[model samples]
Target: MSLHPVVLITGALTGIGRAAALAFAHEQARIVVSGRRAEEGEQLAAELRALGSEAEFVHADVRFEDSVRQLVQRTVARFGRLDVAVNAAGTEGEPGPVTELTPERYAAVFDTNVLGTMLSMKHEMHVMLAQGSGSIVNISSTMGSRGAPNVSLYAASKHAVEGLTKSAAIEGAAAGVRVNAIAPGPVETAMLARLTGNEERKTAFLASVPLKRAGAPEEIADAIVFIASAKAGFITGEILRVNGGKTAS
Candidate 1:
């Protein structure tokens, strides 16, 4: 990779995606932050530029192939090549029990978490394979590998993400493109708040973690940067768990 590698991130408007953009900017990487929201995306790009990294905001809805294709094309067009792509676009999607799940509910979560990740990888690999060198880091969750009550849809979607990450890694490895995923535990993000709902529930959830606390967005961002960097060059087809030893058992 070049001194200022071009990095593209989806769901860059908030949470871990936003933090990853900043973390890469701190490394002096050229970045493209993508999301459906134009205003927030533009602001994030400006912030990255302020930190001395070349940056741009591209609007994209990962659920659609056309949107994702345009996003990848625009990144390559503007930056010449894509060195790293962080697929952080996902959702919790109206958490409820399996008995309560409707097709509408399932689609709402799977479209963004599963289909979105797949499409992003499809297009990203297309460019990376041609270039013969690139890295892709996908975002997964602790629930991805474990079963949880009421959050079945989200967990199932993340399981699909892990499957995609591993399969894509195998396909891309021989072509010089590496794919991996970070399965985060509870993080102090807006999504976490929504998931927990109340302070009592949130505290109880954190107690399950050995660390007894939620992770910070920056912590996950740093991990993303490392796994996506040359430092973790030998690593692929793996899921780096960042969930405060929640899966230690």
Candidate 2:
């Protein structure tokens, strides 16, 4: 076996996931980054390679069970084993009042956020259990712990993710596979660009945050890297909030 570990990150083509790929690459960890965007995924893989890190791209859509399974299979095939798994693939559906939310919108959010994470973990953990050691970090949102206006669907999906994290951790403890979650606040990403239309809305969002600023993707990625590394070996089933104290208010 190589001295470096194998790290698999989903949704690694963009946002926080992209930052994490770079973070792990810098640590000399062999990386397998999976995402639906072939161009961006391949580009990131090339970037990692340029940094002298062993990396590969596996195209996958987490919402589909088969695609998620194939992603893990490809990772194992390439690296021979998986030491860490990050389920960072997620979606933000149309925001609206619960009464006005359509079944289509609800299903879309749940399918990608809840079902997607579950399927990815199921397949990843299967391999981990057999190896008798692994760690999983699921990316959730701060809204998972608190209710937010006009985001019931999204909030619910993240809450489900937290629940899955806890339950999986309990079950995997005996197998030496740790499971946890990372809940980030308003990070400077394309996903939050949708909420940056008006100055008042933007300020209001920041006002609740004690840091008085939006979080950077790199910051969130750092938290994830710590939780997924050997440093957090004794920790499991925790939702490490990287929300800039927004939930404090």
Candidate 3:
């Protein structure tokens, strides 16, 4: 791997993905910032370039195989290789009780959260395995390990992500590729706002965390960078949870 590796981050327009992009840029890694929004993706790419890293924005929707395939292909075309991939593209879907869920609801959540991660890893592993050395980080969630009310679909999708992570890790280890997932707790992001719905409810939810507050995007970004770095070379098939100790039971 290059000392300054090429990194691709899906869903890079905002929140944790955006934070990870900035963190990698600070490390001087060549970056591909991907998201569905053309304007926002371009703006983020510009911002990363301004930070003195070679960065480009690729429009992609991880829900589809072709888009994800092209996203990785374009990243390799631009950088010659992909050294790190952060499969951060995911959706919380509509949070509702299991009884209220429809097949459409399940598909919407699984498409992005489960299938998106799967497709992102599918394409990334193709490149990484050929190179014979690479790292992949999938963004999971605290819900992946345990169930939560009103967010069953999202939680189930993340559970699938963790399963994919471990299976890929085992398959890739012998081939010099690494796979892992970061299961973040409630982080301060737009997604969290949607999950909590309002200030009072948000505070009530935060009270459950041992830290008594939501984590910052930058904090989670730091963990992503670490997991993708050589410092974490021996680690794979692991779920690194960063949720203010919410899952520490």
Candidate 4:
């Protein structure tokens, strides 16, 4: 058995998830990275392997329960145990006002963000409960704490994630598992690029943030690594904001 712990990170192909994979790899943890993008996942796994860490790419669509269960089971079968999991796979739907939003778009966001995170946590917790120790980090957003225009459905879904994280953390604390959340501000990722393709809108969003700049995916990954490490053993049910001070306003 490997001396280091095993960490399974969802959405590990790009952006924050990819950054977290590298961060954990630096910590020498065995990494099991899962996502629908097989090419990206395999590419990332290769990079982690180059860093002298064990990495496996598992393709999963977190919206389905079977995929989530399979992800956990495969991690255990590969590394013999699971010590940490990061729920970071999510999407921002079409840019439209609440009244103009379609039910289908709303459902899609909820299915992937809210329900997917829940399923990841459910299956990971089942493994952790059997092991009796683990750590989980749910990737939330600043919108989770407050409402934002043109993203009502996405906001609502993240709020649901926050609620789930807190409630589940309380329940899992007794099992020696720590559950925490990270609410990141606008980070310079492909997702944010899609969110602010318009120059005027991008400038407006940047002006609203106190830092006057976007964050790096690595920054959010660092926060996840901190919470997943032994340093945060006593920290549970807490939401760490990595929003470049955006929530202060």
Top-scoring candidate (lDDT): 1
Clashing pairs in 2: none
The lowest-lDDT stretch of 10 consecutive residues in candidate 1 is: 92-101
Question: Per-residue lDDT of 1-249 in model 3, one digit per residue for the tens?
Answer: 698899999999989999999999999999999999999999999999999999999999999999999999999999999999999988999988888999999999899988889899999999999989999999999999999899899989999999999999999999999999999999999999999999999999999999999999999999999999999999999999999999989
Off by over 4 Å in 2: none
Candidate 4 on 56-89: residue-level lDDT in tens?
9999999999999999999999998899999999
Write out the backbone clash pairs for model 1: none
Q: Where does model 1 exceed 4 Å of error?
A: none
Model 1: per-residue Cα lDDT over 82-164, one tens digit each:
99999999999998889999999999999999999999999999999999999999999999999999999999999999999
Following a full C-alpha superposition, what root-mean-square deviation does model 1 have from the true structure?
0.5
> Candidate 2, residues 44-64: lDDT per residue as tens digits?
999999988999999999989
As for lDDT, the candidate ahead, 1 or 3, is 1
**Whole-model alpha-carbon lDDT for candidate 4:** 0.92
Which of candidates 1 and 4 is the stronger one according to TM-score? 1
Model 3, 195: alpha-carbon shift in Å?
A: 0.6
| Candidate 1 structure lDDT | 0.97
